[model samples]
Target: MHVENSLTHYCIPCDETVCCACVSSRHAQHQTADLVEYIKQKKIDISKHKIQIAAEHLPQLTKELEVLKQAKEVYQISADKVTSKAQERAELMKQVIDLVLDSQLSEIQKVKDRDLDTFIFRENEICFQIEDMKKIVADENGGENAESESDFNIISAEREMKQKLESFSISERSRPLPPKFIQGIDDMIPEISRLLGKVERVGEIDGGVTQRKSAAEVKVQIMNTVSCAKPGHKVTSICQTSSNDVIVAYNTQKSIDFIDRNGRKLKAKKLQFETQDITMNKKGDLFLTVNDSSLIYKMKTPGNPTQLYNGGPYKALGLCAQKNGNLAAALWKQEEGIIAIINSGGKLTETISYDRTGNKLFKKPYRICENSNGDLIVTDSALKTVTGVDPRRHRRFQYNGGTEAKNFIPIGVACDSSARIIVSNWKGNSVHLLTSDGEFFRFILSSRENVTYPHALSIDSLHRLWIAQKEKVVIVKYLK
Candidate 1:
């Protein structure tokens, strides 16, 4: 309605620029200021902000962009490498198939060569018999006037010739039937497809950090501390998002909570039942394992969680994210336990029950984590030991705490960029470091240093460790 009129004044009450017509209309009672002055002030503010951006934000963003580009380059190189490997496997399979094909063709040639040998022999024999018969009729000698009337000898010769013919005859089944090639390519497609192997998209590396301090040179110090649990809520699990926000799961209260970096509270998602373990996927969806139900649930950010899987009678006791963007869920039933490997689509791809020598791998898997080297780190709370399994499904080592830590209760497990495993010793009230090969390195933190009963552990991109102990979640930076 005011498109035809030019704005000249700013209405203070309405907080909008007004034309001459607006002055006598709804904006007549409101205080007004010169639009030209307001425009000047806005320009001044924009210029000031532009200077701040150039001095502060632009340089930081440029560096961040460079880091992001490097990450992209790394990802592409890794993908190309895997693709070449898969192609090599396919080429090898093709060569093997060609060998099989040549084998069948060679067999057919063998049959042909064998049948031709018998046929040639029979042909020569029949020719000789025909020559003998010709002699019976005449020409026993070179001249045409030999003995030409011998009936008894002719009858006896004919009987003997029939017996010779019978020796060269072949049985019907013994005769070759030309081998036909039927469809054999797609018979084991499901199995043959697996031979090429899957292209696993490993989990992302936040901020592209790939370095860590050695055990001997590490300095442990508290970086930041946050508390998400209420007075009586028990913190069962704690994990970090890509943005470094904390997500805590409560088993006693049957709820999941979130908190941002600035200590501001985010929207908390409730749960229908208590969960023992919780994990976040690459897609930012949170997964939790209910203690009583066999169902595993996935929760979208700022939304409710729904059922993502059912593990039959073996309820999931622990959940963790795999480096291949898959999920590692530990389930227990009937005093036996197994770790189920699930893909991103919520389908169970494989299950690990026994090691290479057919020995039981675990009886109770409490908490699980996947290392950067594709090894699985699982804590068996029942046995009070940690099992390290390699990618080949071989149990590499079982780490029962050292002599000093007799009653070790390993609760949460995590790994740094160098594959150094950090375990929270709940009973010993310390955090222990283990080499990538599962050998004991040293204790990084202990209750003597004010770290009491470390329950869950998480290492972030900045090399900060978030340890959940009691009602407080403490962030520790052990890497120098």
Candidate 2:
């Protein structure tokens, strides 16, 4: 409780003022003094504190202020330099704009003149025809010479009319469309990309850069690239013999080319049979599948290809030699998909049609390969899936990419010695690796590595990858 006593005392030990009633209660044990005398002593202490502050702290604060001003002046100089550089850039940009304008204007004037000349010529020709026809009509309509015209004049006039009619032609050139103003940033990405290059901060400190997940990384080396430069030829399928020689199949050109790992062209031949797939068997003989059930084979010599077997009425697309020396072919029977296994003696042994759940294995299976473990790997283009089949002709696993698979249209399938499968994603523009059990493991190739629109895939005996691009093939050395 506070007292309203006008008289107060200074409790020196507590450094507080107290009323008479309070000095006798809460501060009864503290030493006390007169309030007026304590005020006079405090005023003296304040004077001494001001003198200390002016001597020590004030000079230090002034020095700090001067340092701040100097640092700000340095920043101001740099700012001035930046402003000057920007002005210079602006002047250069204006000059370039003027040059571009002049070039575009000249092209426009040329097109305009050409179009106007053609239009004027056509108009004058039509005008002359109209005037000649009108004069003949006027003369025939009794313009003072209708009754007096002789037979020679009439015959000559008729011949002239026939000549004009026969020679009349309104030749039309392909219409020239008005030029459209194309927006260019330059392809800002293209020709002049190096001109006004990117401006970025120098000596940027790296902060928490992202690393690709180890699970999503698989290293592969590109050994060589074999370019298929034959005009009108497109790569369809690829196969490698046990000796690491590559055979590239092309459809439009009706050709199969042979090349080594060094990209040297060994030989090429235009095949007599329409080839849907090509592969070499255990005897180093080539097996060629036509669009139908006909299978053609040839010895190492490029002689006349012999039709090995013709299974009736089925469309065959892709086939591969199995570990057991049998040939497994993807056949279309009655608009359905079947993998037919042919014995070494060129007779149909078994056909796999459905999975364990009675689900159709494939809608349209095109490319096929057999793993070292006798698991037949097939790429179903219509279903966009890569399926694995065991030696028993039973469906083992089917993969269409996982949840992370984007636009996953699988095109090519290859198996290595480890039974690992590689599938090329056409729409995704990437190549993916799969575990032996048909699970998506990681991406081994992508568009960033120039693996765009990849189609055919094959693995040689050395476990190297031969990937076919649009017009070229690359032999890549696979890593773990």
Best TM-score among the predictions, by candidate number: 1
Kindly list the per-residue Cα lDDT of model 2 for residues 1-480, writing each as its tens digit: 556464468876454678787778887766666677768876886676557556755776697678778877976797687778767776787799799999998998898889888778878888998887788678668656536678898799789878987766664553455656676765645644455444443321111113332223545778888888565456778988667778888766667788886778898877776567777787777777764554545446456567766755677778787655778888766657878777766756567777777888888887888875567888887787888987556888989876435577887888875568888888777887777788766667777786778888988767788887877888888654
Model 1, 1-480: lDDT tens digits are 556348888775355778977787887755666789978986896787567547755766788789889988988898898889989999999999899989988998888888888778767876887776677547434645655758998798679768866755557775456656676676677778777677664443642323432334455777777777766665778787856787877777777777775446686777788878888877788888886668898888868888888988897878988645888899888779999887777877668879888889998888999886668999988888899998778998999977545869898999887678989889888888788888777678876777777887877657788888877788877765
Question: How close is every model to the real structure, measured as TM-score?
Answer: 0.54, 0.53
Candidate 1 TM-score to native: 0.54
Best by lDDT: 1
RMSD of 1: 22.5
Give the C-alpha miss distance for residue 58 in model 2, angstroms: 90
Residue pairs in collision within model 1: none
| Distance from true location, Cα of 304 in model 2, Å | 2.9
Please give the lDDT score at residue 136 for candidate 1. Answer: 50
